[model samples]
Target: MKNTMAEDKIVADKTIATKVIEKLREDIINNRFETGSRITIKEISERYGVSPMPVREAFRTLEGEHLLEINPYKGATVLRIDEQFVRDVYGVLRALECLLYETALDEIDQGVIQKLRCINEQIRAIVDLPYGAAEYVDLNTKFHSTIMEHSKNQKALEMYTHYHEIISTIRKKYIPVPERIRTGIEQHEKLIEALEKKDVLLVKMAVDEHIKSALENFMTQFSQGK
Candidate 1:
């Protein structure tokens, strides 16, 4: 009975930690907690009506994402997001996406192609809506995920999903800008064309260029803002 109770408690703490991680991830990304802002386990625990144990677990995860720095003496602090941070995130994103596409080539069928085409149509139509950035991110994520989901590499797919969440948040934040959106749609169309031809070389080129263009557009806008 004691063992079962302990296991249940562990599960409960993990559930609470996941909730806290989600809330805190978005909060930090959206600048609710500005860069260099300090956060303590006790404060977050009280705010979320949870215990310090779960909050501590969440802090470890946020730190892993490079959004926070954990200090043994000073609790946690939000990290500065700069050009280097963007590059590092997108760099891994590019590699993972390229690998996903490579592995998915054997699995690419008419069904996946049609799904991407359908999503592309939605992307085109979304621009007409007054507020569609969030939806756009969803569609974009769906589009990539549909391709990446075919990979036999469970580990890479999981990491891809995690990184893609961060990418979507950044994209959603910049949704008002037409430049990045338009460029993305164009590359996506190119990717579909390459996929249709089953030209491995072109597919590789298309995916590589797609990531490059996204990084370029993000850098341009991010630099101008700074």
Candidate 2:
């Protein structure tokens, strides 16, 4: 009976840790925790109604993703968004996205195009609605992720997803202004038009321009402390 009870406790501990890790991951990516804010294992345990062990496990997991920085005797804090990190992410993304477009030009099926169109419509509807900063951020991520999904390059897709996760974290800190959102919507519409025409060159140019514009906007906001 003692041994059985110990095994059950271990299983329960693992389950709780997994749940905590997942929740913390989402919170960090969604920017619920501000950069440089301290996150205590005890606080997370209380918030999630779990034991400290699970919360500690969660922190370790997030630390591995560079989303959290853990210091002995000091606890964990959200990682700062570095401009170099953003440049590295976007640099890789541009190359992969361009490659995806080039390869997809020859292989993009009707089904994929239809799915992309559907996502664009959803983004359009979201933009038209009265939304808060958080809603706009979420919609903006969905819009870019949807395009990557149709690229059909598994390695490129994985890298793009990771890059977007980093970008999402940054966006939460400096929410894009309403004007940027409007410009993004217009750019999305134009990209869709380019896709419809099956013009890979046009699609690549539009994507690169859109990413560059976003990077510039982010830098401007960072400088202004918005």
Candidate 3:
């Protein structure tokens, strides 16, 4: 009975920690919390209506994810992000994405190719709708993942998934830029054409150009302090 009770406690603590981690991650990514601002267990617990222990545990996890900077005396502060951060993350993403495209194209069937087209259309349909940014981002991610899903490089796929967590929030910030959307959708069309032709060179080039455009857009936003 004592062992069971201990197990239950462990599970409960884990659950609380997970919830706290998720909340903190979203708030941090959305810039709801001030970057470089210090946070403490007591204060975060009070605001989140959770206990101090789980908040403490969540801090460790966020720190591992590079979203938090924890110190012995200063407690924790939100990690500051800048253009270099964007360039580094997107740069790694570009290489992985291009490789995924190279490996995935030969195996991708017409059905998946059609699905990509439909997703691109879905992305293009909402350029004028400001509320659609989140949905647009989702569709865009789906469009890429649908293709990457075909790649046989399990290791690269795993790495891309890990890296995407860092890039995904950064991406959502730039989706509201209409030019990015317009250019992205056009590039997606070009990408699909390349895929159909089995032109690996064109596909890789398209991936490079697409990611570069996104990097440029992200840099533009970061410079404007938005």
How high is the lDDT of residue 204 in model 2?
89
TM-score of each: 0.84, 0.61, 0.76
Q: Identify the runs in model 2 with alpha carbons over 4 angstroms from their true place.
A: 1-80, 107-115, 125-128
Q: In order, what lDDT does every prediction score?
A: 0.78, 0.71, 0.81
Q: Model 3 — TM-score against the truth?
A: 0.76
Q: How accurate is candidate 3 locally (lDDT)?
A: 0.81
Name the lDDT value of residue 6 in candidate 3.
26
Judged by lDDT against the true structure, how good is candidate 2? 0.71
Model 3, runs deviating above 4 Å? 1-18, 41-46, 50-57, 129-134, 171-175
| Model 2, span 1-226: residue lDDT tens | 1122222232344588876776676666555678888978877776667789988888887787677999887789898656665677678778887877665665556776676677656665666466644576776666666566666688877776666665665565676676787787788777777777889889988889888888888878766763
So what's the TM-score on candidate 2?
Answer: 0.61
Candidate 2 residue-wise lDDT at 151: 68
Tens digit of lDDT per residue, candidate 1, span 71-150? 99789989987888888889888888878787788888988899999998888888657666667777887888888888
Best-performing candidate as measured by lDDT: 3
Residues 145-185, model 3: lDDT tens digits: 99999998989998888678777766655545777888999
Please give the RMSD to the true structure for each candidate, in Å: 6.8, 7.8, 7.0
